[model samples]
Target: MLNRLFLPSIFALLIYGFWVSAEFKVIAAGVAVFLMGMVYLEKGFKLYTGGLLENILKKTTSTLFKSVSFGLATTSLLQSSSLVSVIVISFLSAGLIGLETAVGIIFGANLGSTAGAWLLAVFGLKIDLSSYAMPMLVFGLLLNTRAAKPLKGMGYILIGVAFLFLGIHYMKEGFDKFQSSIDLSAFHIDGIYGILVYTFLGAAATVIMQSTNALMVLVFSALAVGQLDYVNSLAIVIGSNIGTTVTTVIGAIGANAQGKRLAAAHLLFNVVTAIVGVVALNPLMVTVDEIATLFGIHPHDYTLKLAIFHSLFNIIGIALFIPFIKLLVKWLKSLFNDSYSKEPLNLAKIDESSMERAIYLNPAVLSYPDAAMRALTKESGRLYRNTLELICYGIYFSGEQLRNTDNLSELAENWEKEEQPWSIKGLYIRHIKGIYADIIHFAGALEGNLPRQQAQELFALKVACRNFVQAIKHVKHIYKNMGKYIESENDEIRHQYNQLRLCLASVLKLVDILGVRRNYNHIQEHAAQLKLELHEQDQQTYSTLNKLIRSEQVDSYMASSLLNDSAHVHDACTNLIDGAVIMITRDREEYREYDLAGFTPAAQKTSS
Candidate 1:
């Protein structure tokens, strides 16, 4: 309800303000332009995300200190903590970085964000930045029209900087004009009550603006013009710091649970810092003054003093929180768990409708290449397992029987005494089809949005998914005949079909092990082993069929049926092994089926 009313209420309020005061209109326009500049800046940085930024994150996120340093440096340069937060959230969702490292980055970003306040205070109030805007905008627009991505990214950065300068100039001008017309200082409340009221107003403003940098610049503008007091401005800074988490929280709404946890951690860090800043305002201000002196800052320059205070308080927050990040992560995980968070498998709680969908495949992950690839890989793993289940059920067997049973002959002999059959078609529709479609659709959507190597990875994943689908088709063709002949009166026919099931089962067991035992040698060994065994089974099927035919132990009809079914078994098993190898090894030539390239023909003949 509040969300529904928020936009109209804000619109009405802005309209009323515009009607009443020309100064208010200018200030609001400045804020709007500043926000637009920030958006451009974020976009500019994101165009460069997958290369240097992604590499830096991977290398630096190993330790809390390194993570904090990375966050501080990036935020200092980019001047957008929101951009850093987005990157962190994407990495967290992708399982690229740990929650502790993410929390540390958030802590450092708060400190780094204070650099913006310093930049605006020191330069924005002193210079006529409007003089710098025009040339930047012209160059930016020209480069923006270029086809090259790097040129386009540079263009956005220049344009964004120009708008920021323009916005600051207007805000400074508006505040000067507004101060002459009416004294906002006359309405200021004193001491604790003043701090409380102003802080609440600041937080509300940030929530509406959805930006700390813009809010800081606006406050700095008013402070420079002597329309707002330093003490109240400090309270507002605290409020703005707390309010910044709103952007992080909103960004996480469509993200995975890991992203949400990082969002919560951001809120907690900011709120704690805000609380410390509020409770120890006098002592902290004294500390800020002392720190300002060390840097030769004029004691009367409240704008620089405010910047010092902002950086100091955030540093204090980091000093307080860094030691306990692990405990915090543990608590947050306990509070929130994803449906797919139960480690390797055990995804999809299996609804009453008997339908299943992709678990790791959320839209929020699509913006980042690493996140998107990881999500697809995890979803494909689930698809492989589900396809295995469907194939096993199609042929009158269970995964448990495939893995555990040693006496497959006895199990097959007793098939006639079993209960009624179920439809492989219905089973696939219920479970496998939805998941497969989601995987394929997501991969297709991700195409052209990735780097060259990652795009190749996406293509390999699609091919693996296709292989799984083909395996299902082959199994569906043999399913009916298996059901009919497993109950055959003739023992020889039943035995031959039973052997076919065992052949397929052998491949299933190998694929199943791929999920459990993640060793490199195991993947190579199992893959090569399946190829040789399946080929030997093919030879044995042909040899046994000829013996049964020539001895007239089987009629032509039975012989033809066995021949067709054996070929289907070979094809199905081949597809299963191929798909499993591709999905597990992730298209790496070394780990893939080419590892079986060294198999000897003599060894195959010996196995037969």
Candidate 2:
């Protein structure tokens, strides 16, 4: 409802301002062009995100100080704290960094953003940058026409910088011209009430612009032209700092609970900083004056003074929060628990309609490659677990029975006495199909910004999910005759069906063990053993079937069913083992090293 009215109202205001004064029109145009530059700048930086940024974050965010330094460096380089915030949120959602580390990064980003104010105050206001804008735009346009993505990204950045300079020029000239017609200084108020009012106005401007850096540029330009008072500018700076968290809050809307907690931390940091700045305004201003004098800045240079205050207040906020990082993390965790922490695998209360929703895929993580890949891999694991459960139920066994590490033959024999039956088709639709579809859809939707190796990992996980579902489908084919044969009057056929049950159950148990194993060498050795055992079981079943048929222990009807079911069992076992290998093996290179070790004839014969 607000959006419907707000947009038209802004348009109407723009139309009226343009009709009222040419200077007002120029200022508005300057603001628009500046905003466009900000958009392009963010776009250019985003092109470099997936791998390089992810690696930097992983290497640098190990300690709180390092996280803060990384955040400061990144925000200073990008000139977009909002982008940094979104990246941090994505990292937290992806489990790339802890909440405490994320909070530290947010703290550092606030201090880093003050550099924008310093740059604008010291250089932007003093130089005639518009003189260089035309050449930059020309070069940027030529570079944009190139086919390479990095070159195109560089072009956008150049164009963005040019537009920003041009906008600053226009805004400065427009404000200077407008000053002759009306005195903005006459409207300026003094004291605490004035600070409160101007701070609120500053926050409103930032919320409307959605970029505090842009707001700072505008404020500096206006201050240079003697249109804004230093005291009110400082108040607006405080408000803008608090308002900057809106971007993170918006980004966190689709994020997991951890992302939301990081957003909350961002808001808390900014709000606390604003409150501190407001409460200690007098003492801070005095210190800023002293610092300005010590640094050889003129008292009349309000733009530089504002920059000093911006940095000083943000540094104070960081200092205040650094000691309480653990407490803040504890509070955030207490406020927001993991969304998927509930009973994810409760079979008794399965909601058929809820299968379409993703269990691990969060759109917020897509901005960071590491986070996005982790989400895909985790969701694939969930799908694999669900497939295992469905396969167990299809074979007239409970998931519990499949997971049990007790004597497999005794468990299978005991489960055979139970008459429980389930619909494989129904379970597939309710449990497997929807999750499989979601996993494929989610994996396909990943941004093309991932590193080649990570992209391959994502593809491998998708293939693993496909193999898991296919294995379950194979079990469904055998399920039709499984219960019938296991209870048949012929002891030979019944025993063979029981053997098939035990063989598949053993494969399931081995896969579960593989899931928990951490050592790369142990995983490889165990996975090879599992492959050899399955192959041996397949050969033993085939030999037993052939012997029973030759001895006339099994008639043609029984032989045909057993033969077809034996093939289905082999396919199911092979698919399950392949999928489990992909899921458990973290390093493809290690798996490659050990893959051929298990296929040797000597090892195979010894296992058999």
TM-score per candidate, in order? 0.84, 0.85
Top candidate by TM-score: 2
- Clash pairs, model 2 backbone: none
Which segments of candidate 1 are over 4 A away from where they belong?
341-355, 389-431, 451-457, 476-491, 508-543, 546-564, 577-608
lDDT of 2 by residue, 244-312 (tens): 999999999988788899999999999999999999999999999999999999999898899999999
lDDT per model vs. reference: 0.80, 0.80
Worst 10 residues of 1 by lDDT: 595-604
Error of 1 at 284 (Å): 1.2
* Residue 448 lDDT in candidate 2: 70
lDDT at 537, model 1: 80
Give candidate 2 regions above 4 Å deviation: 342-353, 364-371, 392-431, 447-458, 479-494, 509-536, 546-561, 581-608
Residue 41, candidate 2: C-alpha displacement in angstroms: 2.2
**lDDT digits (tens) for residues 384-423 of candidate 1:** 8778777877677765566677766676656544453446
RMSD of each: 5.5, 5.0
